[model samples]
Target chain A: MDKKRIEIKNEADIVLARQAGRKMAQSLGFGPADQTRLATAISELTRNVIQYAQQGIFEICDQSNRKAIIIRVMVEDFGPGIADLDKAMEYGFSTSQSLGVGLPAAKKLVHKFSIKSKPGHTKVTMVMTRKRV
Target chain B: MKIPILQLKNLLLTSIQVELTDRDAIDFQYDVVHKVAETGAEGLVIDITAMDVVDSFIARALNETARMARLVGAEVVICGMQPTVALTLVEMGRELIDVESALNLDHGFEKAQRLISAKKRMPG
Candidate 1:
């Protein structure tokens, strides 16, 4: 259960964090498509961090057992958290006026997804599992 | 010479082959619209097939560039988005409304041609 943490403070760090996620996925035997998924998800969360809070922390942890290789991710920020978590998770309810599809889309790409937020804190966690063939 | 947009025969083509830093994305938006002005191209095809990720920043840049291209009288068509990138964009709430997309580069050309022709026929 080793975890690698990244601090996202600006736009450039989002790129760096994605690169790190890609390398980790490769080393963990994630296929190109899944690597893209994980990396893209990281981008979504980290970009949210930079835009909303201006800074946040992300962690990627390996949680494999005898069955499958599991990649767990946690993204937390101290920015103003989502006021309406339900609306945020809805596919088209976007306050920022982008497509408003990010959170729901990320949920669809992973094995597990969860989120918690308040006035000054927001945390999102996702788990991606790959079969060890 | 690190040109962000390439022009050939009345169409502006840009392939995002690598992960673009935010600065690059912003500069790309600037150059693409101005390039439309310089070349007077009737169409634009942005191939993001080689790009593995299209985060919100990149998405905004692409969407803005599309709007700007339209403002300059050039039709824009996006092509070569991998399945994963498309899905990611969906989840990021970046539907990129108003941007036309095609399955691949070949189809993108066809779509752009149709759009260009349609624009020509419209009363200006």
Candidate 2:
């Protein structure tokens, strides 16, 4: 696993983090669709950081093989975290005026996605692979 | 809700004044793009200044609107993006380049007029 990490503090950092992750995933030969998915997933997570946490850390690891590249991203933030994980995961549940599709959309964009959050901190992990489904 | 079609000289401006929420993002994209194409406008300016926040979906829709507009010889300019809204959009890595932006409706109209004039100057 080739691991790279970055900390996101502002909205600008989120853009950089997502671009970095997408570039790394592409360099490792992830398919275009997967690359776009990874980019979108990272975008969603980083948007959360800016909107909710105001700061977060993003980590990307690459797992390469003959079949495809497996990319994993982890975003962590310390802020007023989620009180109800289930409710937050719902499609139309938004604390802000947003469509509340960030988490759900991110989950759909990746092969696997998970979230762990408390009152003061939240962590989201998403994984994407080039292996054909 | 119906999308209002505003004709301005050679350009056609369509206003979809729906809530810029995630649930409406896809519909907004479809309606706006369809109307822009149907009107055969030389350029399109999406006025989202009425919206408070633009999420990933809306941002994506803007990008798509630009792409779709371009396909029909029309350019799309997104105007009235709030600072915070712009920040969120930038963080989301959505491409706004395809759609030119203005600070407000007046500014967008000015830019659009200039662009239309520029196109007119160019030989077909």
Candidate 3:
């Protein structure tokens, strides 16, 4: 398993995280479409970190075995957590002036997604898996 | 990174060929709108053939740019969105619904010209 962690603090970090994630995905044999999806997913999540949390940690890990290759990502922040998780997931429900599609879009791009948030902490985890052919 | 906005007659042309940060995206939006107003251009073509990812932020930036250009009486056509990027954008549910798009730069220029002429023929 290979793991890499990046600090998400500002807009530049958002770009950095997504590029690194895309590079990792490419190195792991992900196709062009999947690579773009992974990069876009990372972009959305890291942007949320900058906009909402002010800072966070973005981790991408590769856990590939004989049968399948699994890529897992974790985003953790220490900002004021989402008060209404369900509402936040809804389309067009944005606290800011944004389109509010970040969280939901990130979720949709990945294979598995889950979120846990409190007042001072929020963690989002996502996984994408492809069978080894 | 600075995206150069080139003017050709009554049309403004620009291509986003870099991995843009949020700041870059916002700057590009501002630059395009300002260029449109300065040149009194009737049409604009933004090529994103090099952009492999069009997340919600970039998508919103492009949409806002197009809207701003239209407000200044310019027809905007975005072109050269990669197939993978389009797929990802659709799956993410953040479509660029507010903007006009074409398959490539040539087609986009043609479409933008057509729209500009059509608008000109309309009585204001």
Candidate 4:
């Protein structure tokens, strides 16, 4: 499966990325719940990409025959990376003025989530299944 | 811009009737919370069905309203949570622990009635 990538630079891009995630999920016949979850997760991550990273790329990939889709979003910037992954995942923890629910909410929406970050880069990957309930 | 306060049986329900877009969300939230608190209502029903998206700020304000209402011995119920709004909230991970939510206005009223009734039944 070819990876589909979108470079996000602002808040508007976050909205577009969410719509894209929902469209892809719907086209694959995922349930409404799953579709909403995926769209919301993507929106949260993409917003972070614009706010914290200043820019990032959102990539979507289809896993053949597994009835699953993989969303790998990488938000990269020269900004300071998170010093504590654990604290970053904690609810109500935020470095910005906005509500600190971004990372934790994204984690809750997917089956598999992983985060890798350095002093200048952050990559978050989440996997969702297309199987109907 | 005006949120009407309605009284139903011992419970005072205020419908949050505002068209808050992302642009005015911050101001709208602050105004709503303060007004609801001032009304001294026993309960509040915030209808956000007109809102298609709720950013982090709006979510935070809702949480703040819930807390404030509880402090004043009132309950806060959020209604008209569209699917997109719900998804955004879940994604933001904003804890609505302080505020109860329903799919629409009618359902929210039903739930609020139950909660208020239950509270009355509790041993004082």
Candidate 5:
């Protein structure tokens, strides 16, 4: 499979990330519900890159087993890292005027979630699995 | 670039049948607020069953539209969020707590009716 990846530096980049993620999810046999979940998660993360860091890379990879294929998304940005990762993950916590549902809510959209950050770097990863059906 | 807004009785309905860009969402918000004023509609229902996803920007615009509608004495109901879209929005931390939403268009119409009646009963 061709590695699904895109650079997110603007509103258009965020759209591309969602489309690429959706295509990868579709190829991995993800159901429409799961596909939408992955795409929305990608949208949320790429939006963070544009809103916070101003630029970033969004990459999609696949891991497979005999019965299932896992689609993984990674978003990395060199923006202002979260001062409090834990706080950021809490629902209803926004440093901006937003509804504060971006980071913490994205965690629930996938089977797995992880984030790491320091002053100029932030990285988030999410994964969903599609069992052959 | 104008998203159609339909007026029925005392209610207004808008169904976004196309993929929306940031510009679309922005223009939609602007249009919705003004339409509510122009029509003096008491209820607004936004049907999004055809939409599979709403990004953060769109989410914000929707929330703003809801608030603006309320400010103009109109109650807004968002209806027909697909199961997947609902799940994703909740997971994304956008519960849209401030806006009233329904499971489908029919339910949305019911909710709009209720909200309008409730407002009429409110002491001014």
Candidate 6:
């Protein structure tokens, strides 16, 4: 259960972070489907960081045991926080001319998701767990 | 990296062989449209068989590129999407809906040609 942190600065950082997430998920015995889910989720989150916050950090860790495996991810940025959390979470609503599915869709990929934001800081946390077979 | 766009008669072909950053995706959209216009191509087929991740940004870029190519008088076909990518997209709320797709490169070319000819027969 080692923790890893990635810096999110630009579009390239988004790709790097997602690749790292997928690699870690694969090593932890996750399936292709779940790996993809984690990777895609990370991609969206990091993208939001770049688009809105200009920069951020992507942190990942595993908390698991004999019968189940849990993956935890946190993306945080010190920038102008979201002006409206409710609208940002709504599907098909985007101020940046994007698909606006980044936040809500990312939430669906993981088992647990939460977010908090203020004037200078925003954090999104996600947990994905699967029982080992 | 800038992807190479090849030409075959009235058709233009390109394949995304690596994962692209957001800038690369936008550059690609620009490149595809300019290529179509430069060649006055009738059909364009983009093969993304090697791409493993088509997140919302890439998906939007692809759909936008398709729209721009169509506006510039070329029919577009996107082919060879990985099943996992397709599954992930579906889970992400149905992206890539604006473009035509096929099973593989051969089918993609055929589909693009069909679309091109179909448009050619239009009254306008």
Q: TM-score of B chain for each model? A: 0.91, 0.78, 0.96, 0.74, 0.94, 0.96
TM-score of each: 0.85, 0.57, 0.97, 0.66, 0.87, 0.96
Which portions of model 3 miss their true places by more than 4 Å?
none
Candidate 3 lDDT (Cα, whole model)? 0.91
Candidate 2 chain B, run of 10 with poorest lDDT: B88-97
Chain A only: TM-score per candidate: 0.93, 0.90, 0.97, 0.87, 0.94, 0.95
C-alpha lDDT of all candidate models, in order: 0.83, 0.72, 0.91, 0.69, 0.85, 0.91
Residue B16 CA displacement from its true place in model 3, Å: 0.5
Q: Against the correct fold, how does model 5 do in TM-score?
A: 0.87
Total residue pair clashes for candidate 1: 8
Candidate 5 DockQ vs. native: 0.58
User: iRMSD (Å) of candidate 1?
Assistant: 2.9
> Which CAPRI level is candidate 2?
incorrect
List residue ranges in candidate 2 displaced over 4 A: A64-68, B1-9, B12-124
How would you order the candidates by TM-score, starting with the best? 3, 6, 5, 1, 4, 2
Off by over 4 Å in 1: B1-3, B87-98, B102-111, B121-124
Write the number of the candidate with greater DockQ, choosing between 1 and 4. 1
Q: List the residue pairs that clash in candidate 6.
A: none
Q: What tens-digit string does per-residue lDDT give for candidate 6 at A1-47?
A: 77899999888999899998898889999888889889999999999
Misplaced by over 4 Å in model 4 are: A1-6, A63-75, A97-101, A131-133, B1-24, B34-44, B49-58, B68-75, B82-96, B109-124
On residues A1-133, what C-alpha lDDT tens digit does candidate 3 reach at each position? 7999999988989888999889988999999998999999999999999999899999999988899999999999999999999999997789999999999999889999999999999999989899999
User: What i-RMS does each candidate reach, in Å?
Assistant: 2.9, 10.5, 0.6, 4.0, 1.9, 0.8
- 2 or 4, greater by TM-score: 4
Q: What DockQ do the predictions score, one after another? A: 0.51, 0.08, 0.92, 0.25, 0.58, 0.80
Which has the greatest DockQ? 3
**Local error of candidate 1 at A74, Å?**
1.2
- Per residue, candidate 6 scores C-alpha lDDT tens digits across B1-124 of 8999999999999999988999999999999999999999999999999987888888999999999999998999999988888888888786545689998999998899889888889997
Q: Candidate 4, A45: how far from true, in Å?
A: 1.6
What level of docking quality does candidate 1 show?
Answer: medium
